[model samples]
Target: METSASSPSVSDTPPGHTRIFLVVVDDTEEMRAALAFACRRARATDGRVALLRVIEPSELQHFAFIGKIVEHETREQAEQMLQRMAAEVNRRSGHLPSLHVRQGKPVDELLALVREDPGISVLVLAAGRGKEGPGPLVTACGAGLGSRLRIPVTIVPAGMSEEEIERLA
Candidate 1:
């Protein structure tokens, strides 16, 4: 499916059931820990997963064509990545994962997604396990003392095995 500004989700929800979705912010890495965690939660709750990938804005604003091309490529990449992740979720949890591609700031786009789609139950992220600190998205969402997200945020730490993630979810 062609991705729009707010890309449509590839849903596999039961016809009558309202889908309660867990929105996981997909970044540079696979973040397998978070994916497994979200899938398990979705399976147990009879919901689904939405893998969201945001393309950070480029500094190249001189020409509109460059921005469009970049966005197109980014969307294609996100779709392929989400397809692989969806297969993994289906294999692990028997649920088809949905793909949501957006542009601009991660936190802002996430909040916009929340505002646009009430089906989203929670936002999941992986804590940066480096000396650098909790990842930008986590920190941007006010990870520590001041959590700003209206919806609950789940931050899975690094080194969590799939089994541990399964247990946590």
Candidate 2:
């Protein structure tokens, strides 16, 4: 995959200049909108978007082989989804989003990635418009955890149009 100097792929970056805006990507339109917002912002900042999806770990101790197959399939699905998102980013923002798949709770994994990667500058998420309120990860991260985290979390409201996101970018 060819990379440009201004906007690099979301997954990889040049040494000493890897500013990242991590986006929590899920199977939701709200998540997609958040990703779009992150891509625009990253492009504006000469950074990249790390598109991350977390899958729940399988519980198949009764059948270890089946559990392994389930795990593999889950990872594949996540990859396919991320690839589609990357393509959208390329089409809309002229940048390829970096893809990541982790098997664990979203909040824990997201926070761990932030701790592990110093290049990550912010966590981007979409506020769920559901009556129950925002998703668990967004609520947890936006709660008291935000103060403890090294990076800030940017919450894009649900249904924000592409034009508004571009303006913010």
Candidate 3:
């Protein structure tokens, strides 16, 4: 978890006081839509944005040494990606977002983060446009995983244009 040390802890905030829009950072195309929606919504609500990047464990079970190296490289890559995305979030929301990196299944990590961070008022996701279906996280949310979360989930359509998002968010 690479959060800003200067910022007050969300757990310290009174209930219903802090509004942090939490968005999962991933390589999928719909991720951009989710990010845009979260940023715009945060700006509109005078809230902050929090980004969570979950690093799935490497699948090199046969080679312990190789798995360690791969895990280190993966963490580094996730950190770099978070830095780049944080800049974009800042540009869009006029504030730098809190960055977090966790190692586990995406759904589990997301749930844990929300449970741990009291300031995360909303979980923003984007429905995929692919013929297959919405991406894994969104699908998981729809498959009863969302009911386990303490915060509301917001799903943005992947094909929504900036104009539409601006008007709605």
The local distance difference test score of model 1 is 0.66
Which 10-residue span in candidate 1 carries the lowest summed lDDT? Answer: 1-10
Best model per lDDT: 3
The order of the candidates by lDDT, greatest first, is 3, 2, 1
Q: If scored against the real structure, what TM-score would every candidate get?
A: 0.79, 0.84, 0.92
Top TM-score prediction, candidate number: 3
Model 3 per-residue lDDT tens digits across residues 1-169: 4443233444555658758888999999989989999999988887778888999988996899999999999999898898899889889988778888899889988988888877789999999999969999889987998999999999998799878998983
Query: Candidate 2 — worst ten consecutive residues by lDDT sum?
Result: 1-10
Candidate 1 residue-wise lDDT, 1-169, digit = tens: 2242232353333333544445555663436677777787878877677777777776667778997787678778877877777678778767666667777777777777766666666777777677767678767767442254556777777767877877764
lDDT of 3 at 134: 93
Give the C-alpha lDDT of model 2: 0.73
User: Candidate 2: misplaced stretches above 4 Å?
Assistant: 1-18
How are the candidates ranked when ordered by TM-score, highest leading?
A: 3, 2, 1
Q: Clash pairs of candidate 3?
A: none
Query: What lDDT tens digits, residue by residue, belong to model 2 across residues 75-106?
Result: 88887877777788777656666666787877
